[model samples]
Target: MGIVSNRQNASDYDDDMKRAKAAGIDAFALNIGTDAYTDTQLAYAYQSAADNDMKVFISFDFNWWSASQGSEVGAKVAKYANLPAQLMVDGKVFVSSFTGDGVDISAIRSAAGCNVFFAPNFHPGQGDFGDVEAALNWVAWSNDGNNKAPTLAKQLSVSSGDNTYKAALDGKPYIAPVSPWFSTHFGSEVSYSKNWVFPSDLLWYNRWREILQESPRFVEIITWNDYGESHYVGPLSSPHTDDGASKWVMDMPHNGWLDMAKPFIAAYKAGSKFPIEFLDEEKLVYWYRPTPKDVDCDATDTTMQGNPNNSSGNFFRGRPDGADTMADEVFLVTMLKEPATVEVQSGDISVTLEASPGVWSHSVPMGVGAQSFKVTRGGKTVDSLSGTSLRDITDTCPCGIYNFNAYVGTLPAEAAIDQLQPDGLTMLSQGLQVACPTNTLGASSASAT
Candidate 1:
């Protein structure tokens, strides 16, 4: 669905209806900014939605152009806030600000309302949306800031927008907001918009495709009338201007923007079976937080000689003198994004140990010029080498005989890992190494070499 929450004028509804009906838009969201709207005005907006057969949504950017953190902040919000629990004549709930916690939605949803949508933090930075993971989760959380139900866009913004990633945004939602008219940087020949062009917007489309590949969220187009940010997809004309320099050129969007969206929407629906976005792939529509781990495993419980029964980690190449104990689950892949450290004690020997973070980081030393386990870190995880029958000159630490492990497959492009998964390792004491054959190995002459 495409959302245009900052709209004004009663006639604009007629115009929007006319345009949407002709455009084949499945639905459109409107932002009814405040309760100052009379019952008649509210009814007009809904009636227009019904007449056009367009699924309608309403919103209010309570903050408008005000700072969210000013001392007058709450007061300002109160001034423009909708009646604590008032419903529009259409009985639909609307948002004042698209940001997650701007209003208490859960409380209002209990009122007589039709539908409600949330517009989580938008247009942050030039490269992407800000607080990406938070934004992505909104689709699942219904844009609930405090875990409120009946959240915003319970699904996704198949056509919503995030102005421009002037920042780094996690592409959980494919939706983006566009207002070509407001942007002097795009769609205009004005000296102000020297770089914004049909091509500039392509950056977002391509980037979004990458994020979508990881999750199943959709996209959103921000405003249908916001022609100020210079990122608008609509006309950038000032109705009050008479001179040719300050007037809007009608039907400009019909000229090109829709054409750009058509093939894209079509291919997205087609599921990338025949899609192209420089380098496209199947996309994800949703995501859940990964399994959380207890980072503070044990500040003083790890053994000097780690467990030998561990298959996850089986390569030992440590003793760099200040070595500590082993960790649980953490590896090169995830350590970087969320690093961790722990300490273990072995009677009078307590050491704080830190893990190596990176793909194929901290190689393993099988023994005597030979290594047993290797990992690749990037994207997901993979083996440093996925091979079948191999011949080694030194049969050192055969199959499952090592005492160390690290993460793999958390690096980029030049993949050291191809197929194998995390070969986690644990430390084994010299005495214990001697006690366990599988945990220890001696160099042996190999004929396969």
Candidate 2:
């Protein structure tokens, strides 16, 4: 499901539908607030989806809707209930809400002629909507790095609980969620930043595998365009751009995550192992936190206060998990069609692994030097990628704020080896460098065109 902006116009909807369809998605779950301006925008989106031969649904934001507006909400919903682009399931129009506990689902459905297929994410266990047709839980955070085994175990626990929730429906559907990463510092208005992360190192791969195993009727990628959350897998262009958030994200591209998701999407739908193909050339895509755990690179910048609404786990709970203290390491996913030795060079701590056909990932300790990678087979280099030069330690945040955005960079497939030149050095005597100096202010603040 695509998380779309209600500010989008007809043309923007057309373009986003085209992109989402190309990526094997079927619908855009328009995340809407209770505003007349948004109501008009939703109309344009519905018409655009109908024009593009796609489906659209509404995800009412409870944060924006009051409990007393039930009938009004229903009337507003019924306006688009019969639209051609409105997603229908088993003769009912599909509708879901974000934390819709206060808003009475049954009352809204009754007002809408009781013909809605309701499946709202009501946070968990606040109250049960036993009459709703389906169940949805958007709890897709594991917040761990590439330690695959433990990550899978944690996800399985979620899936296990979801399975029980599904069983309560007695054969109705469950919308499972999957995400690539989460870091909302640069774009949040809340008191504290959402610095938690689920490693993108094979994240798309692992999440899809787990989702397929759980066999949910529907799967929603956590976001297609919530750029502030830093989990967006769609383009960094306009209409689908920032919702009054940071400009830092406009330059930090996660489009590579979409490129990495194609195979997984196909496999999940077909219920078979879809051989991952190279959408682009064989490359190593990577990202990492610029500042590590509890490391203050900028003393002048006041660090954010704790989020009172933050979930109780790992980094959000003010307690570090086992992997929480793990240094900020470069996470790389290598796609190769043949066996090759992929080397991660950070300072003198160079580690090489024999990567066979398909995608495999590795993490190397980041240090006070440039980071780079090379793929070689039979003593000949096949392809190589040069990363951005690491920044120096500083005593101030570039934007004078606690910046939590990941510094994402890529060594393009066609990049010259000389482009990745790093200072020759030996093993890092310490672990991964926890914090790197922030880049110049506004360096990552380019607005989308």
Candidate 3:
């Protein structure tokens, strides 16, 4: 998991580490910038990781760094190279970066004066990897044909960037990135220009399946807490929202995606082809934009064109690219212990499918009104979500801006509940355990076990 440095205390880092560890994450890549508090935050993170029995490594953010400051970067990394929580690969310190493609690797290694395993996120064709032990592909989303300020257009395929990086490494270790969604909104108020939404329909499920198939040496979830981009999977914390991201992040909880990922993480570690066997309980995780696709936003917002650099003079105040392609649909994934009927109803439109004892995903056209979901077996309700607990789908945007962010929820809504303990791990409830019959059933079976 990628954790941006905004933590306030050791307890804050401890809380995040415990939750990540419970989710089957092996380590935390602390994303550090040149902020003055970075050193203090790193100290807290390292000590917290050790207390939680988790591993950590430093990931330098190049936005505030320059290639000429290789010595400074090396010195910062050397400071924590010997920490007990430091992640090591083959007895060497494991270090990474966000976008230091031009940084001198030899200079960093020489200054650190230790064996280093460098795996920076140098985009394809941008940096030399001769001295690198591994490479990390940072392009987690698919884009339109335009390279500069490309629109987040197609469903990401492994062959798009993963295959290219793997081929370039020529058998070196590759760390692949997996994320649920990506949406960023910023105007002239912020110095950097960013406003776009990637096509994320069922991306959480699709990407995990791709990871199990490709089986890279390692996988990094795009972020654990990056509210500004609206892809955070961690519970929203107020202290970390000083960057003006709370406008879009508050009240938008994504923990449901983490609940859906538990089984996938277990399957990946076990080298299983499918995550069905790893699923211990039945669950129905669903997500959708609170507003319909046709809603208009304030005219002052500039739509993201090709290249955020704005060198092509494509910048103008309007709707974002790929916004029109976003399907007005509700996406859901179901894990079942027996054959059951899954139904999704939005307003007057209802869609139903007979799902078997396995992991399955489907989407239905979204309707404006109260959203509801249910699972039935032998004419009896097994699990469901209804009433006012869920946010209603409205025709108007809540934020008054082009809010493309999603609000995720689960069917057995209580199944998503988690309580953190003093030990830093969550006390999970065994809510949806079901007993299956002896007879093995196929996907065609419509009867309950």
Candidate 4:
């Protein structure tokens, strides 16, 4: 996210920082254009970013700033020789939040030892800006950035726009910045959609997903703050915490965007395609399971929140990496049944699941891949499933990383699964896991055909 105009001063930035770190936020300094302080202030914000662990962007919000700042914006950012070249936490790097008319960004990239990312100020979620000019400007910005190469282009083959971003496609280097947001009760958020998060009225999830599909490079999630905008996906809240289930909504380093960002960044880094569920105007991603239980278990033990052995395990409830979500009255396929004779290939046998109504999970040790499973029970027969291809999954939510992700296709349904998508993949941290409904999801309701 950008600067909180009121919090330009380091001390004042506390609230903003608190919010940013909340829902899984990564910080990008946008002080360049604020014109909020003097040369000393800029220097201070620079140090403040370092102290706060935020990467300073040459936002130089100069387009409309006072003329005096206009001249110094570029030079000032250039002057900060020691500022972070990339986001200290996620490695996105110091960049220009403000596009249009700037210094030779290539020179800046070389100086920073990284290619700069471009963050355009445009989101219908916040409020439509009336014109596509900003979008057009971003496109222009990409072409402009592309004309001149930056330093790290050699080391990293990142692009400003992979596809959705027209500018980058024209040959720019900045990743198409897609600001993913979330809303949680405790100022904690991942999407603008309300899950006790920031509220919105758009299918924001699908909105951003389209954006991600448009770009193959970076996609910056908007604000990392539970900033009061009802658009906050960060744990930063309104000086209040809602006690329903999640406590992080009120705390940080304990709960906030920082924690949420890990899974997001990882998902993107892994190139996992996000599986989204509609939440009002905002299309939000799932952070916590409807119930806190093992994805494979149908049981719930709310009293044993602290019990690791309990099916309601403290599994991250997180989506990135390997996380298992507890489903109510549902069971992940724990024991696979062989319907036919087993055919072992080489040394192991592959088993295909019959998850038309259930999800299956796999339990395997690390360093085990390109390997198959064994199925032998009372002369039970096992059919072979394919482990040949890995799906090129995209982030359900966009973050600035060329991530890889995937999910298995579920049985065809008559309609979109209730509350959940039929094709959604439940992440499992412990064993290889998949989720299936004991009953058909949204069997009666079709997709409004």
lDDT of all the models against the reference? 0.29, 0.59, 0.72, 0.31
Highest lDDT among the candidates is held by which one? 3
Q: Where does model 2 exceed 4 Å of error? A: 1-8, 143-157, 160-164, 167-170, 186-203, 240-244, 247-250, 274-283, 302-327, 384-401, 409-449
Question: Residue 26 in candidate 3 has what lDDT?
Answer: 89
**Cα miss at 137, model 2 (Å)?**
0.9
Residue 137, model 3: lDDT of 84
lDDT (Cα, tens digit) per residue for candidate 1, span 90-134: 243323335533333333333323243323454343212332222
Q: Mark the 10 consecutive residues where model 1 has the least summed lDDT.
A: 283-292
* TM-score of every candidate: 0.34, 0.75, 0.86, 0.36
Query: What are the runs in model 1 whose C-alpha is more than 4 Å off?
Result: 1-12, 21-24, 35-42, 64-96, 100-102, 110-201, 204-216, 235-254, 273-449
Which pairs of residues have clashing backbones in candidate 2?
348-426
Q: Please tell me which model should have the higher lDDT, number 1 or number 4.
A: 4
| Residue 39 local lDDT, model 4 | 56
lDDT of 4: 0.31
**Candidate 4's residue-wise lDDT over 216-278, tens digit each?**
455555443323222334333222222222221111111222322343344454565432111
CA shift at 54, candidate 3, in angstroms? 0.8
Lowest lDDT sum, 10 consecutive residues, model 4, at: 277-286
Ranking by lDDT: 3, 2, 4, 1
